[model samples]
Every structure is written in structure tokens, then in C-alpha cells.
Target: MADYTTAARPYAKAVFELAQETSQFDSWSGRLQFWAALVSHPDMSERLAAPGLTHQDRATMIEKVVGDEMDEHSRNFIRLLSENNRLPLLPDIAAIYEELRAEAEGEIEATVTSAFELTDSQRDSIIGALSRRLERNVRIVNVVDKDLIGGAIIRAGDLVIDGSLRGRVENMERAVVN
Candidate 1:
């Protein structure tokens, strides 16, 4: 896993730099996202890893699937990966690319798991609080976790703040057990 991540870093950084230079950050992001989605699909992963398929065939498939959604540069990059049998790396590459893009934009992604749906104002409040605490723009990814019981658990990168009733109960249980 570490080796793959290490090998993927350069490609991700190169793609990120090219995207930044071309002023096509959003387009490149969308292209990578599409590629990630495609490559991560179970059937597509099997096809990509199939021993009998030729690189040319894989490249053609990618082009066919993404022709309208991707720019020429993204297509060329995909073709390069196909030639090198690196198509399997697309999902990791996309993830790293997004990480770089977010860092460059002074933004951090936060996962907000709540027992119930959050209103627009509540979402805004969470974002505001996170931004104030982290001193960076916060992009919240909201998820509904019924088991949370009540309130929310927020994760901003490595830092997590658990505010749910389930979490509080767990802490209390631990204290009592100890």
C-alpha cells in the first residue's frame, strides 16, 4: 500500500501541476472524478485487470466512456497510463489530485455524520465553526448515520470531534467500566 502510494505521488503531482497551469482545475477534477468512478466499479476493475485485453483496447474503452466529459489533455493522460499499464492507478491518482487541489485552494474536507438530516443553517453553522477552528475553508460532506442516535460526529482530516449521544454514552460506559 505504501509503495503504491509512493509510486502514485509523482503522477498525481504532475497531473495537478498540469491542471493548474492550464487553468482547467475544475475540468481536470471532474475528469479525474469520472475516471475514479469508472475504475473503482467492480466490473470495470475486472475488465481493466483482465489479462487478455490489449492496452490499445483499454485506451479505446476509456476514450469511448469519457470522450465528451474530458478534455484532450485528460484523454492523453489516460492514454499514457493505458500504455504503461497504469490504468489501475486512476482512483489513487484522482484522490491525490483532489487532495492537492483542496490544499492549494486553502480548503479542508470534513465529514459530518449526523443522526438526522441537517438544515441549511445548521450546515452553515458547522462550516463556520470548523473554518474558525481550522483557519481554513471547510467543505462539509454530510452523511446520515442513524446509529449516531443524536447530534453529529465531525471529522476534519485527522482531527475528529464526536458530539453524538452514542459517543457520550460510550465514553461514560468506558469510564464506569474503568
Candidate 2:
């Protein structure tokens, strides 16, 4: 799995550079998102992987669906992927490209899980605190898990701040046993 991600890095970088060079990054982003969704569809994935389907036919289907929505560069990129039998890898590529884009913009994704849904003000406060701690713009994705009982957990990249009631209880148990 790591090997696959390593192999995909070059392709993802090349596409991102191409988009940046042509000033089509946003357009490509939108189009690739569309293509990624289409490619992931059960019907389309089956069609794309069928041994009987020719590369040209796959390209044709892609063009038919997104031709009007995408720029020429993106369409050509898709054609190249189809021609090289790499359509199935578009999702990973798109994800990597988005990661690069976000990093470039000094933004990081943080997942916040709490016992209840956070109010807008609470969410904003959390984002502010995380931004100060991370020294980067924080994008919060909030989730509610009643099992958490109280407080919230924050995960950003390799850092996880477990402030939930469950974590505190576990820590207390460990201390008593020690």
C-alpha cells in the first residue's frame, strides 16, 4: 500500500504542475473531482475495468460525460489516464493533489469529535485555538459521538489531543493500577 502511494506521487505532482502552469488548477480540480466521482461509481468502475472494453471506448465515455464541464488540459489528462489504463487511480491522485493544494495554502484539516454537535461559536473557538497551536489555518470537520460522554478529541495529521471524558477515565484507571 505504501508502494502504491509512492508510485502515485509522481503522477499526482505532474498533474498538479500542469494545472498550475496553465492557470487551470481550480478548473482541473473541479473536473477531476467530477471524473473521480464518475470513475468511482459501481457501473463506471465495472465498465472501466472490463477486459473487453477498449481504451478508446473508455476515453469516449469519459469525454461524453465531462467534455462540456472540463477544460482541454483536464480532458487531455483524463485521456492520458485512460490510454495508460490508470483511470482507476484517479481518486488517489485527486486526493494527493488536494493535499498538495491545501499545504500550499497553509491550511490543515482537523477532525473534532465530541459528545454532542458543537455550536457555531464553539466550533469557531476550537478552530481559533487549533490555528494558534498549529500556526496554520485550521479546517475543522466536526463529528458527534455520544459515547465520548463529554469534551472533544482533536486530530490533525500525526497529532491527536484526546481530551474526551473517556480518555480521562482511562488515564485514571492506568494511574490507579500503577
Of the candidates shown, which would achieve the greatest TM-score relative to the real structure?
2
Candidate 1 per-residue lDDT, tens place, 1-178, comes to 6776776788899999998898889888888888889988999888888888888889888888776766677778888889887888887888889999998999999999999989999999999999999999999999999999998999998889999999999999999999
The positional error of residue 82 in candidate 1, measured at the CA in angstroms, is: 2.0
How large is the C-alpha RMSD of every model relative to the true structure? Answer: 2.7, 2.1
Off by over 4 Å in 1: 1-7, 40-47, 64-72
TM-score for predicted model 1 compared with the true structure? 0.81
Clashes of each: 0, 0
What candidate 2 gets wrong by more than 4 Å, as runs, is 1-4, 68-70
Q: What are the TM-scores, per candidate, against the unseen true structure? A: 0.81, 0.87
- Quick one: best lDDT, which candidate? 1
Q: What is the C-alpha lDDT of each candidate?
A: 0.88, 0.84
